[model samples]
Target chain A: MSDAAAQVGLPPVTPEEDHKVSEGKGRAFLGIPVVGWMLIFFGVPYFLLFLQSLWEPTAFGVAHNWTLENYKLVFLGDTLSGNIYIPTLLRSLKVGAMVTICATLLAFPIAYLLAFKISNSRTRLMLYVLVIVPLWASYLLRAYAWKVILGQNGLLGSVLDQLGLENTFLNNLLYSQTAVVITMTHIFTPFMILTIYAVLERLPPSLIEASKDLGVGRMKTFLTLVVPLSLPGVIAGATFTMGLSSGDFVAPQLVGGKNDVMIANQVYSQFGATNNWPLGSAIAFVLLGFVAILVALSTQAEKREQL
Target chain B: MINAESGLTGAPTAGAPAGHAAAVELDNVTKRYGDVMAVEDLDLRVEDGQFLTLLGPSGCGKTTTLRLIGGFEAPNRGEIRIAGDDMSSRPAYKRPVNTVFQQYALFPHLSVSQNVGYGLRHAGVSRSDTAQRVAAMMELMQIPDVGERRPRELSGGQQQRVALARALVMEPKVLLLDEPLGALDYKLRKEMQFELKRIHREVGVTFIYVTHDQEEAMTMSDRIVVMSNGHIEQDASPAEIFDRPLTAFVADFIGDTNIVHGTVTRIDNGHATVDVGPLGEIGGSTDDDLKSGDRVRVSIRPTDVRVEAGAAGEAVVQDSVLVGGHIAMKIASGDETVVAHVARGSSYEPGANVHLHVDSDRIRVFAAAEGA
Candidate 1:
């Protein structure tokens, strides 16, 4: 054969045909199991929940009735008993926003330090391990730990008492919105750090040097070059933090007061003490929808930034 | 003309103006990385509008020297001056110099035009002026149409041009290029070398280029500073370096040459007669004073050695490599092998005995102890 054909090594074939054949068989082999797994674990439950949300809460359990009362009770009720959904969701969203902002602000410098400032690989790995060590502990245990730290007679309260500020600490230190926000920020900050660090680590050092050589100062370089490039990770981190913290039931339950209850706590009460699966499913779907919208918006923003 | 204090001093060339402040000067600059010295006490003066190249092998401190001038690095013991201003403590951004980094380092996020206009924007140039200058630089680089494309979308050569445009558009007092064309393929590298030279001439900015490729340095640099082991081995014009390398390291580094070791038998005026064991006695010019029994090395270019049909001093033809336009024949003279470039059509078979003649005037002798 000719040199061209020899270099190509095989007879010419249409790529689309080859792709179709490989995808038809190979996709079924690999993709079918994953698809089946997702459907079994995620799809079936989610569909059931959606169906349940359309029914009504009965004396014993839920009844098979097509009604919008659950949603109406969720969105339109006036009092806390009539409609705790709006207040709880609004509080959850506020907490999520605060957690996201605080976590991102706290994580950025830490990620920058790990990725760029600390050049020694062992030291960087140690620091990264330090961030991940807290994650290895049980999530519920961590939430409870936050409860002990922020409790009436716990570490913070005793410290405040020693400092002669017992009155201020006794009134609002434990079972407050600040306690929940603080705990949520602390727990979720590592995820943001890891994500942003991953992106920043891949950035070539020469780009920063080039920016400096071009007469841009350190702050400008960070703003114009480093931050823009690390944005996808930032958005991903925000989405993850927002998604996790807003839907979290434990942190709010352990450290939060009645005024600071999140939507997840309401969902839990509906499923447990209230015996209202349909209303619980509706609240869960609302939280899921909100998180989904947030994730979609963030991913879209990240895509636009890339372009 | 060359001195220990001044390193290697060549007479001011046409491109270098008389009695002007050196575009970039390094005085007693020493950069140490922990225990190892990256650049030892070195003195260098790059004249305005002159393309001075730091040409060396890996770990030879060429890139380190470029980084020093660009203010990416500060000397541990000495001073760096740019355009008569002492820049010893100034960071890279504060210094009035820019660098075309190795592998381009073009901003992947920015378009070609934005990347090129980066410095202009930082310099407080208005949008209209930034655009005009960016367009002008792109046109000069012959990449006017690639302004809208991202750096990753461009080919290597195009990326290189964009890098050049970026650095040059800044209108800095000096441009530090750190192996800027090192990433391009051979053909594109050759093309970029000419482009760089043309741009240097057109812009007349002091360009300090770093490269390990000797041919690239010779082709593009007005002057080449050959470095080895964190010190300058030789600094001179490309022709002067090629013709009369100050040390054996420079002779070997610049091109293929026969480094014949010999001991001086006599010194007549400025020339010395040295006994090269296998090649017999050869007369060559020396820069250092030589005694009757001083050891020296003599460098002979391959093209200067003549191989004739008649056998006077017997040499066995070991190999004949048919390079285009000429044949590089390696002949064994006694125990030592001497390479000669003969006309391509010459029919000399391996194992044939051929007579070798050295062009006495073209031989350069250096003190044997000065060899790297």
Candidate 2:
């Protein structure tokens, strides 16, 4: 046999066929599990949600009628015009953006401390436990605690009343967007800290020392080396905070007023009070789409940062 | 010309020869971590453009000494000076020195060119100048193609070269290399030793290298400062250190040495006749100050002792080993065993009572009390 034929274990003229066989098997090995899981969970649920959004609500439970009316009703602002759906959606996006920024900013210093400042393993572990312990508590309980703290007759009001500043505090602080943001930030801050901490921990200490040895100051080292290297964590934390805050219905419901209602609360309202299941499903899908877009953008940003 | 300063107290003048300027001076430098003293009373000087290696085993404060010089840690006492200027209060960034760490410590996230350009960028050099300097450094290190590759993407040797380039591009007066070739394999490390020596010469910067490997220290350094227990045991050229170690620690550390304990029986001229327990009276040069009855350890390098067939003289061969480049034989006189090395093709068998002759000039005598 010729060298080419022997090398490929095929006749010279049939190389393309051999290549196809190997490529097909290789792709099949990689694609089967991912495609199977996606079809079973994500693909099926999304398909059902699409069907639900198209179905019209009738006197007998819900009925299937392929129409754009439900989507039109959501967009037109004529159905429950004065209600909180559109405003809540906008508020949720704003809250998500705010939480993302806050979490990222707060996480950087804590992560830097854990990764570089604390050298002893036991001390680092203890600090890590302290940061993570809040996460073990019930999310609802934490949100409820925030409500108590911000309520008119609660912690803030009591403190302000003692200081003779109760009037100003009550008017601005309780049941507001600010209150919702503060609560969400508390709940999600650990997630951001832990994610960023993990990435920072893997960073080689030598790089920082090398930076210093090269006559780069501490602040410059953080800007040039620490921040750029730990960006994946920042992106991950941002995506997580955005996803959680935008989809969160409970925290805002407890601490937020009618004006503070987010898109999740709107979806809940559409499903429960209005009994508009199709509109609710459409709104939920829209939120999912929005999150998917954000996730994609963040992933693209991460890749660009890597380059 | 040598600085004509009178005593040790006199400051080494500024216009002293390039090799006598004391580019780096550590006077009574000490470092303590809690109760443990990592470095104790380290007094060292690196003349301008000298390649000085801090040689020691692990945890011997060689790395700590490098850190002190780099201004990474403050000494508990004394002071550090770079070119006669005190730098005790200066942080690592402000010091005019850079270290190439053992692991190369190349920034994994950055391309080679970016890492090399980092110091220049921090120095506020123009972007174009930084790029030009980085390219020049890459060319100097002979790794121009590796500039675009991330550290992990390159081989061990490639990463090493990039690290050297990165530190050298800064044009620091002193370059501290903390076991820089420790991560490379034997052959590669040997190659890098030569490359580093060449680079040090070409750059004309004082290179303070740290390594536990004695062979590497011997090959690359203009002078080797042998350290043990955070104290300088002996500081000399590799040849002097190997051929004339002042302490048993330096004798044992530098290379293979057969140390036989003996007591001086007689003193004549510069030669001392020693009576080793099993070995009969042997005469070796007394390079140290010793009394007639002073106990001493006689250090003989394997290469200096000669083995012969049958009893040509008064030595008895106990065992013979044929290592590739040379034949190593263990010879004994009574109860004392001495290791001897012969040329590769020598046919010598164990149990043959052979004569052992040593080059008297190559043997070193040290006080047994100083053995570590």
Candidate 3:
């Protein structure tokens, strides 16, 4: 075998080559579950939804004849409903924007403190658990927990009444767009925090030290070095927050007023009560497309900018 | 001679011309991180326009001392004076020194020009001046064309050049290099050693280098401060360090040596003869007091161990390998293995009787209970 290999000009098989051959098998084995899951669960359903969006709705179910009316109606507006869909979508986007901005503003300082200020590994671990422990609780429970805290007759009203300041704490703080934005922000800020924290933690301390060593002070270092380097994490977290909050229907259903009905709420009504799967799927695809465009834009911005 | 070739005659940025106070001075600096004393009551005076290296093994406080000098870490007790200014309480940005970090730490987001000009921008240099300085520095580092390229896009050697350019552009009072060539391959590191030396002489900036590699220190530094266990073991020139090491640790750590335990049998004039067991007596000169019966440790370099073919010998040749310009041979003497280097033409087969001659003038003797 050795003589044949030498004649063929094949390099002698070394330990490193032997190890790489075994590693290839392990890699393929490790990749199986994700591939299988994405194919079976995500790919099939997403394909069906896309197909349903193109199909025409009939008396029985979706008809074989394809139509663009469902998509056209979404953009052009429904004449009978008096422009409900577009306004609801704009409102959902507004709510998402407000929530994302609020969450980002709230999360950056916390993540910075978590990554830099806290040095003890045990303490950092404890703080990390504290941030993540709230996530393990049911999302519905957390959304409703905001209601218990912010409701007009719930925690705020009682606290105001106890403090003897009735008129000072008045803002129609429940069953409104404000309430919906607040609830969504509360629900989604943790993802932003964790993302930014991970990015900040992986940043080499030497980078910051180098910045300081080069005659840049603390504030300037934060602006130039810290902020720009962590911009990728900001974009990722913002994308996550925007996509999830804009497409979410739970908060609008739970604590939102009638006027707080968003695109997802319209999507739910189309699918559930009306049984209009084609329109529902179209609306769903539209939201997905908008968020996908946003994600693409943010990713492009991230690629174009480097710190 | 090397500086003339680099084309950088006037380093106007090198603050406080050479005849000022020492470039950097540490007055009894002590730093303790919890239980471990990183540095202890260290008083070091780095003269102006000198390439001084803090040479030691890992965890020897070399890096800690550099950090203290650079204001990255404030010493717990003592003053750090840079250009005769007490900068003990000042932050890193306020100091007159800059550091070329161990890993380069070039800003990845910025172009090479931007990274090199970053300090000048903070120093409030005009935009055009910053550009000119950055360009001049890039040219000096031989990386003029890489200005528009990001640090990640450049090769490791180029990145190192960019780091040097960035740190040197501002012409800091003193430059702290924390093993700047450590990340490079052996060949690149050797090339960089000479390059760094040339640039050092050209720029005329006081350089405080930190490295565990003793040979690199010997090659580049005008003064090498040998450190061990958070304290200075020997602060002297490289030649002095190699020839007359102050302690057992300094002798062993600087280079390969055959350290044998022995006792002082005679002290004649300036020389002390040690009674090494089995291998017999070896004579060496010591700077410290040496009694006739005092226990000592002797260090003998491989080059000092002369070899001769003999029928009756105390050592047997175990192996001989041709290593570049010399033949490195291992000889078994009693229970100990002693290495000896001979001429490239010298040949000795395994199990051959070979006599060893250690030069008394080259042997270094130290107290037995010294730094371990």
Candidate 4:
């Protein structure tokens, strides 16, 4: 609509047409390397994994003959074990749900305080650095550190003993599902806080003022205004936490007790100790299916809120 | 020459309706954010249904004063009352005042109807009653068709109307608008001005508008409070403000006027004869407290200016624009400048030689201001 460009003898392009021009023809070569890399490294592997899920596993090793027996085992369960595949996968989901809820509960308050309450920019930045600082170290180290802290002779039990509280209860903290949940929650909370804070930071202050101006009280305003506005961020964070935690094997291996075996650990053992790649790939698809549905539903919810 | 136009001849509008009270009052209220004193010991009273505008440049505390009234910000000192009730300790939601923010902060996630109905929900109104009120308010704003659209989908002007509708739907005791038309194009702003005035009349709610646009202030306000450096310089009708500014800041800010520094040489009643340095002696008028020996500044409106290609003057015609009904000329020499609104037929080239002339009696002298 501006005449300046036309007056300057330049062709005026609508934003839509301009985007098309940038994306089409000669510019297509610009994305070739990244696209080619994704197809080679990502696309080919996932395609091969899909094929591996359908192949036969003989007594010696994986054979060329294709069969649906591995998929049947994924549904029918391993007769040698007490339905461990389906049960472990379901347990993984429950843990993922637990980690997601706990993480979001802890993250929202921190995000809100940072975005709205802390007016000092330097202070907020310092706190944000503190939150993400742990991500710099190895993820395994953090998970392993939790095992040490939660152990009977370690930090928690020793602290309890120092405080003269019951120390025996601390022994139950490590090497359990609770340990897995607690460690994963601690590890995943920063991502949730970052995502929620990004959206909450962009919330226009005027909107809150306007809501209050209209006679909506502070709590009501937060529920009706702040919560809805931050839903996309919450959904995004929840999706990541759910997807990663449900498929996670490392935390379960390091912190999980004998009964806390998860689907990802089984997926690993099928390839390593068991030497049954076909069953592992088939089991992996079940996890993929659940995570895929969660992601797609969250994305739809996010898109529905957009203008 | 003018001094309060003698009696401020721009007769004040009819006093508030009988039995009507002030809808909002700020008594010696001061608001400070960190080191900046945004509003200082300010007292203001907006009468019921009065269209009062706080007109000033940015950082003049006009918007801050509006926010205090709307309870968006509590004062650092002093009390604010709405409908004769003290509102000092109350938060924005507890007060009976609403604000249409300068940016028109409509709820982007909600549809137009939902946005309008949001505040009503807290009123504990029935669903049908909320619906009826929301529909009526939307109809009043002329935005009924956009009920299902989100805030971003609407045009700027439409969003402004929706904001107004959302606030007014609450039937708050006072409505504060922080330059509601600031983001609109000039043509749309002019149109929205009339729309706003019409809405104000129909609703009969007190409107406290804030804007730095003097023309907008002049065209819309029943009373305009001119502010400078967080203090009020003048609070009067638009005509009085335009004709009889009390300070050099007010005169300079309100119109296209040339301020010429001078010293009073003689006084007759409230009128004075001043020595305008290079411009020589000129007869003008000012407040009686400005004694004959006091330094002064005189204001000459552009309409009072006349230029012709005759004797050599201090300034040459710098530029001229044909502004519909008149030719606006910028004439300058050294640090001194003058703007003259000439007849439509008058034409002057950028570098044309000219002499500026003004009727000596038409200049208005003001007492010199301090560092403020």
Candidate 5:
């Protein structure tokens, strides 16, 4: 063969072809392992759940019917001993919204302090440790501990009584939506602080100094510069708190009375006490739908901000 | 007595409008961080509309001096004045100056226009006027298309221009640029130097630039302050600082020079005769307070040492290396070694025993005590 024909037979000469070959090799190396892992772990479980959602329970076992009855019952609500779950769904959303707001508000100042004010690395580490230490304790134990604290003659009530504030404590202390919101806020506050603090820590100090040099007062700089820059962390914290609080059954069960029992409690009751797997799964699907919609909205908002 | 005429004179153009008055003055300013003094007794006067550079080696307190003037840090002692007002206790936000940091420090989340409009917005300028000003500033920077682009989307040079536009939009009396071109590559940095000079001229604001690179300082500044060890070694126009360095440190720091130690044997008029051992007698002018028989170090710039074959003048060439545009030759007498720059394409070889003629007028004399 001539030289040109020989070269052409060996490989294509274009830069694009060279790029494609390398890219193909790279994709094969990285893509196969990740897709495999996702399929085995996440995709398979989600597929099974999807299939189960469409299945109807029979005397022998469950079988696929692919009916919309379960979804309808979940959304429209069905009479369960003449009581419906709509109120519980609303209560769960209310508790989630309150927890998100409370945690975000409480986290901002602590995160600001950790990121901007605290300079010593050891002290920051210590503060982070303190924030995460509560997670080391059993979640059930923490819920039960709140039960002791919020009870009629618990530590808080005793303190109030000792301080001669028994009337105020008794009137608004426990077993209400406020109590549930407050407990959930406390439980999820660390997540908010940590997420916000992580974002704030990555912010360059020069940006703040530049603002100051540009005649921006301290408060204005914080509002205009620091706050907007940390929106990602705020979103992350809010989504996490909302997801956790909406699906939580433990805290409400331990400290919450009838009015504060969230949708998760109803699902648990349907599955365990009422022995209604289909209804429980339906409620779970509803919760999952709500979370997915919220997460999708947040992701869209994040994408817009990034662009 | 300090000459008031020289101190307060405006630019030379007669019909041209006088720019704003002096914006910043550092009077014997000293800053100490623990045992290390970052700036020691710095006295600098920044003329309005003039670009002054604090040129020095690293750790020579140029940045510290810029920070002190910008109100980012207060001097341990001495007074700083801005617009003839004492700013010793003023915070950065209270100062009538803005700084363009070395890293540009543009808000990564903010668009170019938003970043430039920040100071105006904070100053409570009307929305329409702020928008107009931001647009005009972006146009002036030749980056109108970058108004909506975030900092990360822009190149380093674009980011630098945005930083400048941001600071300039504030209309601060003084603009402090701390190594503003340090992050850019050589070619871009050279381009930005001219751009910065033009911007300074057009905006008519006093600029206090800090850089360790001597060439950048020399190229852009109306006056350069060469500093060493937190002290101002020499403060003069670029030509004067380069040509007439008052100290040995200034001589060595600014450019290549050959220094030789000797003892003064005689003084006549503006010239001093020194006994430089193997080189026999050398003549130079004294910048130091040297008496007869006192040891001194004489400095001659490499460009001032002329090498000629077949005529012994003062020193002999021991070695030579051709470094394009000029031949760098090592000439020595006794234990003292000095380098001379011979013209390129010169017919000179290593150990050729060429005579070195020191330009008497260009030679600088310094007291041996101030060697550094």
Candidate 6:
């Protein structure tokens, strides 16, 4: 109990009581603006999209008559195109997983070096800025820059041609699924590095030394001790990339081939050329559902490890 | 002047038998951080199963020497041998030695048993055997019920024991502890000191402990190496360190004492007569190759100086400080002052004349050296 509480002849506030008071009075009302903002900007639009998905699309405009025809077309497949929605959504997931794996693999070493290996603060600061400076450039420009490099006569091809290795490196290098993965991995790596670096920076250095002192070799110590301790950060970084890349439309549009189109591309086409807002909103919500489930699972896993 | 090698005495413990093999040896080791020399031309040896302590103030190079032995830091010019094998080029991971860090660096993510069994897992011990040994080690540390608890959930004392258990479970040939009790409160520090000494006796490993606490060193160490300014000032048993300090620095650092400045008037067989300006002539033991007219300081433990009330004495009682079991009174004669530790409840008021008697056999005379 606090001295003030004792002097006032009142009981000290327990955590449960404090929580109850916060939930009971003006403090609870403080959340009104944030909840209202989310509802007006997000909740109402999502509800309207759900309603629109049930309405039928007429030639001139959306009909007021409610039906499941749009959902049926999305699930059973378009009459002419067989099962493109499932395959496209699955491809998006695969791309998100691939990008997340590659980014995390490439980020751990850089984060470890930044946090522990570099002894000088000034040098570490310079390297930190180097990692983040790429994010300062326009994302569209960076994506386009990769497009130029991966194209047939771009940097890799021209360099290979100059070396007389003409057709060796050209096949499927440009406008392919691999191209999308590569570009997205490059763009998402800094986020992973920063997250992992933040965790590593706070880790006590003596813990590593203690492991080594107890007859554990360097490599084993890293695998057993360092990796498990840093798993939360790795999960956090993977969550960011997974959430962002699964719904990404820009990278695939600029660098992907015909068969490499993701679900976001289909949704974009429905809203633009097809003028089918109902179908587009349905696809968007489905993708959002998958990403939301993954994020929740990862965060829950992180919390479990905290104990 | 005080010299490094002259103050060293033989190991006084009964555990180290004659011809006992050295578990660790450092020959003229030197370590430098940039241009600053953290340890300089240091040579030391530890007997197998001996509990040795490095006692010094902060920045006294004691920690650097421990690191040198643990292979955490390589010496610029030296040869280190562990169990008669040269370990100068070996890294910390390959060396058969372990260290309990100052912060008790237990793995926060692992349970107490997992932390204790970590090194065993690396060695490919069977799961059952690992569990058995971890349980036994935890039992030895008196923390049998904390195996499933994470380090963050344990008390400071429990965490320290867990760290000890973690390192000892590896069964290393030597254990290095860097101020392991420094983070605990006074009462806990004292308790852990006894706990560490018990563990040392039970395990019979060569334990190299470091601390700046003189009382801790005196209580727990079989031998203590006192360091100052990147050099070994005195290396001997704690009793000798307190009773027969070879230099003024050793005497002043180890415990409370009254130092009276004087110069050697004559030397007779191992005993020297010195003339203190205000207290007149006094005779004490000397070992600094003293000659006539050589400046020196006579060190007397406060308990050795007897105070008697008198009106025609050379000294007068200045004040009496009440320490629980004893009263430490200051006696001033002209410009010289000396403290006498008397029994509690002695009522010697200020301004009372007191005749001071010096225990000549217990007094230590060292040459007054500059920058010691």
lDDT of each: 0.87, 0.83, 0.87, 0.86, 0.82, 0.87
The fnat scores of all predictions, in order, read 0.84, 0.84, 0.91, 0.98, 0.84, 0.80
lDDT of 5 by residue, A10-42 (tens): 643676756887777566766788999999998
Give one digit per residue, the lDDT tens place, for model 5 in B218-314.
8998888888889878778888888788888888788888888888998877578888776567888766667799888888888887667755544
Q: TM-score, B chain, candidate 2?
A: 0.90
Cα TM-score per model? 0.88, 0.86, 0.91, 0.90, 0.86, 0.85
The best candidate by DockQ is 4
Better of 4 and 5 by DockQ: 4
> What DockQ does candidate 3 score?
0.57
lDDT of 1 by residue, A203-305 (tens): 9999999999999999999999999999999999999999999999888888888888899998999999988999899899989999999989998999977
List model 2 lDDT by residue over B131-246, tens digit each. 99999988989898877778888889999999999999999888999998888999999999999988877888888999999999999887888998888888887888877776
Candidate 3, residues A189-214, lDDT tens digits: the string is: 88999999989999999999999999
Q: What is the DockQ of candidate 4?
A: 0.71
Question: Given candidate 6, what's the lDDT at residue B271?
Answer: 90
Question: Which is better, 3 or 4, measured by TM-score?
Answer: 3
Best by TM-score: 3
Give the true-structure RMSD of model 4. Answer: 7.1
Docking class of 2: medium
| Tens digit of per-residue lDDT, candidate 2, span A123-238 | 99999999999989999999999888888788878888988773565766768988888899998989999999988998888889999998899999999898989998889888
TM-score of chain A of each: 0.87, 0.82, 0.87, 0.90, 0.82, 0.87
Ranking by DockQ: 4, 1, 6, 3, 5, 2
Every model's TM-score on chain B:
0.93, 0.90, 0.93, 0.89, 0.89, 0.92
Going through the candidates in order, their DockQ values are 0.59, 0.51, 0.57, 0.71, 0.56, 0.58
Clashing pairs in 5: none
**Runs of candidate 1 exceeding 4 Å displacement:** A1-40, A47-57, A62-83, A120-122, A166-170, B1-20, B293-295, B310-313, B370-372
Candidate scoring better on lDDT of 4 and 5 = 4
